[model samples]
Target: MAAYGRGAGVAGREDLPVLLVAVLLAAAACSIAQAQQQPVYTSIYDVISNRSDLSTMKRLVDGLGLANQLTSGTFTAFLPDNNAWAQAFTAAGVTEAQMLTTYRDPATTLVNFHLVSRFTTIVNGSIYNNALKISDLAVNSTRSYDTEAGRADSDYGLALTRAGNDTDGAGGVQVMGRSGPPALIAANQSDIAAGLSYCNVISAVARFWFDTYFDIITKSSVTASSASFAGLVAAGGQQQWLKDTTLTGTLFAPDNAAIAKVQADLKLNFSTALSQQDAADLVRYHMTDVPFNRSAPVNPVATKLKDATLTWNGGQFLSVAGTLGRPSNNVRWVGFPRSASVVPLLDAALLPLPSTAWKLVVAKSAAAGASASSGFSSFIKAMEAQMVVRYQMDDTSKVVTVYAPTDAAFARLESYTGKPFASLASAIKDQIVSMHVTQGAAYTPSGLLTATPLDTMAGSRTLNVTRASNSAAGVQLSGGQTPRGAAAIVASDNVMYGRSIVHTLDQVLIPAGVVLPQGGGGAAGVASAPSGWALLLLVALAVCVQRWALAAA
Candidate 1:
């Protein structure tokens, strides 16, 4: 019997392939029969009708007369379930009947906001579309998608962020409206297919609210803790301007902690210490006419106050003019209202420097542990060499934009000319230093970009300021005799004595028509001869060699 069983097992192994094929055929037939029995859905309406939890959404779709559109077109609907609708109704302090009756237009808009169509536009040969799916988005990334609620030219949209792992399913995605907390997509309820349409169940309704700059700084919960700025604005009597929704701009509001620190350091009470005009100027210094958002590129922006500007290089903080050493926190655009666009929180108040240009340069150079490249000792010396330049810098009454070269810049000049800056003739040195000094107006980086052909103390020459189109390269200043044709503004907007501002340059600005003596074995490539001592040593060695040869002979 054992021998017979072993032989039977051998026979079964040999016929395994035929048996597997037969079983696979039977399973496929069963799957086909099951698929044929199930009803096919052709629209999002059909899918919503089947799910009892989405009854409120289904009713809204029908009431809004969007059933035909959803039934025929390719769309992705982010619908709030019945529970979500109930929460929204309670939060809104209205019933479903009231929404459908009195707020019909808003109700229609709400439904449309959830619907994303396959509409596309070609701009600059790039195709932009509204169609999006869970598979189309990457994990831990945010993307803005246009919805059906916007007009033809304008885009009203929601920002969608996918968190966690891509395989984490519906729970990984979050939907953010313009002005409220973000809503999460329900787990296991996303990407539900209904023929050409798809449905995703969300936790809550995405909501948008209208708030002006004044409303945000004063009343918004996001800025409640930072009420110091609101106090300053009110104290300045600029409430009317901020409250005006028609005036669209970006406002950098310093937080309470920052305001407190500035008050302590400056020893001034914002409410009592400041005069009306001074307070107004202080308030305006923090604001700009340009509206910047998360989508906007980081660039040098001019503020309402002359010579006060804000700049960010996609870094962790913003660099405000006059505060070169201190950088404020990065701008947050999440909670700002539609009217303001961006109201970033600043960690420091925008104020003028306590000293004059000459004093700042002297202090910076003399300060221990100061960076060689950042120091202006060479610049200070150059100014001192020219009494007129020193006198001009010392004068607090005259508002001037001093383009001071760093120690590194002077070193570069020496390396190029093969001589120290001090070795140059007094008249030439004065011209070189004067070319850097732009008198009459204090210009920030933003101001410099607009104001080209700036007149300098060197009356014969004018400096041409040009910035790269991309703005990442920063601002450059060109004059008659620059080493690289242009000198880059390394550090900008150092507020100094009175209205005077100082910008540190990477290279020295030499005036036009002033010729610099070329250094031997320098950048000019002129070969230098051996020194007198070296020549004597070479001749002595040759004589010794010759004497040894004669003695040997």
Candidate 2:
């Protein structure tokens, strides 16, 4: 149970047993070296400081000279921001000063909970390594019930360890002595606890809970030293371009092991080759260009991704054990210390690519029509009247993704124009369409592409996205902006707009230059007949007839 729910973020797993620990460590070190020599980071420090969301966090990093060590640590931090700080204080029912004074030991303990000396953050989540430090883990073996003592009859020969937050004598994690409150662990214990279950693979978890964990082993860490996108391409110049995409998209990179499996399946090179699109798809699949959180799924519908419909209540073991009439529920378990004992494995499969979600259009429509008051056709008509101003629909209109402008937005527009919107012609209609109709479906930031160019009826507009930015307010299309000018999509995906999908903008965008030429074809005119041609033809015929008559006489 200790290892079951802790920091589990899966990139890819080989069907066979994982490689030996020594093999992995060497790989991790080598992989990190290559990344630094030719970095994936634009400015490593920017990402690092932004993680803390603190202006002072960068100052702290500088003071500690922690940049190099952190980059080298193979660890990830679940940094909290100013807002997170305020929320933590609010939840604790105490000011930051009061908490510092009232719970100094716990405060110290909480800080210790966050700092990790051995762990490093890498892309493909970890599966234990040889660096399983004896000092760090206080593993105590559980006695077997079986009476068999033969060499081949070792039942439960492996240790069944328990874990906790503080270290006991053997240096394993110290289990909480008793359950007073889940709060004592962190001053803002409730929020921290919820965020703890967020996945470990990428940077998205930062948006969900303001904290995240890194595994000791990760795909990025375990990579070969020579690995580089350019090098992979240069080796054969193999890194390929996305067919339609112009820039290098962020990826949910699979490690050598995962790619090796893919290669074996495809029967390609063991090394010196990569399916750039395939690699990109897998990595991007894990990404929510907008932040999509697996941990805080709001409902059963939300859980549809990855088929993780069941809530991970952190007590499955106890519930099962209680049902089975095993030992009392209050026993210490997971890691002999909490840090190493429990881990959570999160599936990135839930968030599919934009193209891939088109496959789920059926599911999306079915779910949309589940209310029983109206069928899909009625739903489509209603949505069309409201959201879309103009567009052609298939005869058996395909389930679509519509960028909905609320009735209120329309109401606002009518007030601005001082004219009724419904009676408008093409010229007038086109402007509204320009603002609403984006090319392709309204893929929330969680979709395949980001920084989508939203086409306005007037002209084209760029609608930026960040992953963590949910439409809690409205128009939730992308992930958390890494900073200003960095709009990424985050949160839930596969949202539908009637038959179509929809992500509304916060406020309807106002474009720069465009004029509406309404009712311009009403020019007055009179019809003219072809009298000149008729008169000329008649005269020519008479002349010919007279000549013929004279010749005959």
Top candidate on TM-score is 1
Q: What is the C-alpha lDDT of each candidate?
A: 0.69, 0.31
* Whole-structure CA lDDT of model 2: 0.31
lDDT of 1 at 123: 95
Q: After superposition, how far is residue 139 of candidate 1 from its true place, in Å?
A: 2.0
Question: On residues 1-553, what C-alpha lDDT tens digit does candidate 1 reach at each position?
Answer: 9999999999999999999999999999999998896656777888888889899988888877888877777778888989988987886667888767776766776787787656676999999754567666787798666677753112246677887664224456887665556777787767767786677888888764334567656644436655887787877899998777576666777677766765554333566555577678778877765665434655666767777666654532244424422323333232222224434455566663234567656655554135677778888888988888778877767678888788988888888777888988888898888898877887888898789889988876999988854332378887866665568877654543226777878888877777777663445322234668999999999999999999999
Global Cα lDDT for candidate 1 = 0.69
User: Model 2, range 1-553, lDDT digits (tens) per residue?
Assistant: 5455342423223422455666788899998997676423323244445444443334444544455643443322333335544555564345656535654433433322333222233557764421122233434532211111111111111121334433222333222211111112112211111111210111110111101111111111222421432233234322333121222211222334433333343223423222444334333332223222234533322211232222224422111101100111111111111211101111111112222222222233344344322112322333245433334222114333334433343443344444555554554345444444444453443452454444433454444443343445233431111112222121223331123444333222323333322232211121113367898999999999999999999
Q: List the residue pairs that clash in candidate 1.
A: 356-497
